[model samples]
Target: MDRAPTIKDVAERAGVHAATASRALNPATRAMVNARTAGRVHEAARALGYAPNSAARSLRTRTSSVAGVIIPDLRNPVFPPIVRGIEDALREAGYMALLGNTDGDPERERELVAAMRGRQTDGFILATSRRDDTVPGSPVPTVLVNRRIDGGGVPSVTADNAAGVHLLVRHLAGLGHTRIGHVAGPRSASTGWERYRAYLDAITSLGLDQAAKAVEFAEAFTEAAGHAATLDLFAANPGLTAVLAGNDLIALGCYSALAELGRTVPDEVSVTGFNDMPFVDRQRPPLTTVRIPHYEIGREAARLLLERIGSPEAPTKSVVLPVELMARASTGPAKPQDS
Candidate 1:
């Protein structure tokens, strides 16, 4: 069996000191050595096919160059794009990402955080932030993504859910939807409560006092919860012509509820969703939704986490990305009978 190439082999080939060869191989230390010596070391390493041990490199620098990402659930289609963005950005920056899914359980989240911490991850990018979290002692450079920890000073990157909800309400009102219904997400999440408040404020500002009663809350951010909430709203106010769902998955549930009631989308009842998840445009009635920059948000969160890891004393930041409305077949002018 052939032995693996070593730094000594590269040093001999380049006629340079072994320490110089090692320093040249490291990106951080490469600049300290003369450019000509570094070039010779690189050439010799390539010629000898010398590969540095990652474990040794980590031990030398006390940095793993890896970030831990904790998400609520991976089953949601919306998460895949976000994960891809994070991975791509990290790869480009010569870092790696470790992903952990908690399935939306607080205990599971705590376990995952502990496991990542044990692994000595440089920092964390968290997408699950409960109103009350028991996970004590976060990573030094942790950054909350898409959710904010209550009373915690961690930096965060989140969509402007309030502004997005305001856009949805205005769109519905413009389409003559005087009575708009809302299927609010779980209040335990920041996005949920923020969106609910935005809905109420928009309705009052639009003078849709008669429509305010149609808003209803969902127990969770799931299709089943959406379906149940939509049904309850329909029962309470049969005159509602439009509904703004908490998220795309919840919007899917609204579709099911409307189908069960023999109602047609946009023809009888218009609907709008948040977080324009993939394949939403290909639904039976292409869903109209607010396009939150999920992938961009993830990439930005990863970048922020990296910055925080580099400088823990940096002032914490709360980044709120903008959103846009994508008009589709699911929403249209309110039915004449709605009024």
Candidate 2:
């Protein structure tokens, strides 16, 4: 009773063979066992406080049982939930994460990748991928999170950007905003480019007013970049009644710009953002935006990377999750124009 509970003990308690108990306990192989039996085995293991010997498993498998996760910046509110999900998924699979923040610097990202590789990590999940990245492929199994490249040879998990953008445009149009401008993110990033492309398509298809000055690109995802881009967009298209920002941070910039230009949101001008990140609802006038499943995206990315580590020759796959539009106080019926 005093000794540490073993798999044998768990099996005995679960009323199953030790081999069945082993398979049921392992996240990778649990699918092969009967679902009811697996649940019983997990319950018995939990009751007995039996923890798998990860160290011995690593020795036998000749793997570090560690995944290297590289993200752009943890400062972004959207990424923390994602990282938490990744850690939870990896931990369930008896693996650990070696995390690094690249701060959107290519050199720093490369250095972190090399360092993690040297540590004998089992695989990698990167959230800092760019569309035009020219770097050679990774030596180990790799999966991208929240972004993808142009060719799409690698596995990745991302939100449905085009669908999300279309929802925003349609909502604004329903509000009678004929002149909608866009504060787009950097085109180098997949999220930015896809949203921008979708915006153009949405406007043309919806028969909204479109012009050369209706769009401006932010140098980065930061608020400062959004602020500058918004100013430029408004200066060139003063008649715009609505603005769609690439992300929540960028939307905050639009709020500041509109205020400085003496435009009241949802009154003189309506605004919407993407990524419905944390605390956006707490803004002066709660932001209307698109909500992507940040946590699920991370979990999916980790799951894909683990599958690749188990079977390296598997064909690459991409996962695009759904998104929702959150309408709030920031968007409203367009103001009436002077006759």
Tens digits of lDDT, candidate 1, 208-248: 98777777888888899899988898989887889999999
lDDT tens digits by residue: candidate 2, 1-339: 899999999999999999999888665566679989999998998898888987776676667878999999888998999999999999877788999999999999999988987887888899888998743236688998998899888999999999999999999888888899999999999999999999999998887645424999999898888989999998988888899999999999999988998989878888999998999999989999999999999999999988887677889999999999999999999866710
lDDT of 1 at 125: 84
The stretch of ten residues in a row with the least summed lDDT in candidate 1 is 131-140
Q: How far is candidate 2 from the true structure (C-alpha RMSD, Å)?
A: 2.2
Per-model lDDT: 0.84, 0.88
Strongest candidate by lDDT: 2
Worst 10 residues of 2 by lDDT: 132-141
For candidate 1, the per-residue lDDT at 42 reads 84
RMSD in Å for all candidates: 4.6, 2.2
Candidate 2 accuracy as TM-score: 0.92
Once superposed on the true structure, which residue ranges of model 1 sit more than 4 Å away at CA? 1-53, 134-139
